[model samples]
Target: MNEEKMLKVEKIRRGTVIDHIPVGRAFKVLKILRISTDPGVTVSVAIHVKSKKMGLKDVVKIEDRILDSSELNKIALIAEGGTITIVEDYSVIKKFVVKLPDIITGILKCSNARCVSNMESAIKPSFTLLSKNPLSIKCHYCEREMETDEIMDSIL
Candidate 1:
């Protein structure tokens, strides 16, 4: 493919670029980022695209916005190998893979429906990271272990 043909999306002068998202998961990333609420920000999403290293991958570009560390942590749950690139003046100022936090709270709801976190109280869901390879978390209240896939539906 020609260089121009290989480039599916235009470069951003400034903002954050999330790369190497698994194929068909770009929208999930957007949902986790709450992109729909930010109508003013310029965002680009490319899905089901070929990647040299990741095979088929998805990418998300947000113009003039840098995600907070907590936001990045939420992304790590779904996009394990995803890289975050901070762009400035059309150059990458920083780049790193999303890292999972030691403890995750309020970002996702507990899988157990009867868990205290799901009740009509002020209690918020909390989880402790148990593993990263296959991605697992244990609910702090219910002590229920959840795999990565199960966590998707429980996302708040």
Candidate 2:
């Protein structure tokens, strides 16, 4: 049997499909998206799936929901290089890879407890993108650097 024939996942008529998620990260995607908490939303997840481009990857299909910019930003913090496809009437209307912004604000909490963003009530947490491939970021207020793991933990 062909690879396509062996794979069995249902299509969503309207919603967003997140593809190329790194292996074992689909649950994190679900956590960040709060998909399980919502009873009305239908979600399908495939983990450790064979991927020609990524070797092993995960795919998340969210039925009847489209992600917003903030959600995309959160996904980028963890699932960088993953692609988001918006489907309408079972057709892809838009597709794009997740890209981290130069400056990320209010989406992630600074790891440093002493950071001004954390201590001060008026300030919101912010970070500056330092690297992409390895995923490094620097806190705007504390100058503390965070890598992918820390970034993943700090998602708000």
Candidate 3:
């Protein structure tokens, strides 16, 4: 029955398939990717679906679109345990779990309003990882600490 349901969205000839996103985060993932309702992009989102591994998770399939490393990093920040699969010719070309960088740069804004990155001259926001399991970061410029939730809210 699940296989039949899954078939509704036919396999893509090429592009990315992001699976095992935490439940209810498919939209946020879309937001992080800045996917719009543009004509050329075919994006499919499945939320709260049952997964043997995840129990209940979200999946996103974007046709004809390949994400870069920076975008993948943003995704890692949001969906820490998610898996990304790169597909071509309807075959899985590459598949791996997202890994957060030791030092995150420019993708998220500093939570501190008074931070130098937030205040003036082009100091790109950068954060040093404070923890990985329950991810926490500190602004490199201002030493402002931000947890996963805070940093998630600060995505640029």
Clashing residue pairs, backbone N/CA/C < 3 A, model 1: none
Candidates in order, TM-scores: namely 0.84, 0.92, 0.88
Instruction: List ranges where model 2 is wrong by over 4 Å.
Output: 1-9
- In model 2, residue pairs whose N, Cα or C atoms come closer than 3 Å (at least 3 residues apart or on different chains), thus clashing, are none
Off by over 4 Å in 1: 2-9, 120-124
Candidate number that wins on TM-score, 1 or 2: 2
Ranking of models by lDDT: 2, 3, 1
Best by TM-score: 2
Per-residue lDDT tens digits for candidate 3, residues 1-156, read 583368345688999989889888899999878887567889988888888887899999999998899889999997887999999999989999998888999799998888889887667788998887778888999999899778778998
CA RMSD of each candidate after superposition:
2.6, 1.8, 2.2
Worst 10 residues of 1 by lDDT: 1-10
Give the per-residue lDDT digits (tens) of candidate 2, residues 22-139. 9999999999988888999999888888988889999898999999999999999889999999999988899999988999998989988888888888888989999998899999
- The C-alpha lDDT values of all candidates are 0.86, 0.89, 0.86
State the lDDT of candidate 1 residue by residue for 70-94, as single tens digits.
7887888999879999999999899
The 10-residue segment with the lowest total lDDT in model 3: 1-10
| lDDT measured at residue 32 in model 1 versus the true structure, 0 to 100 | 83
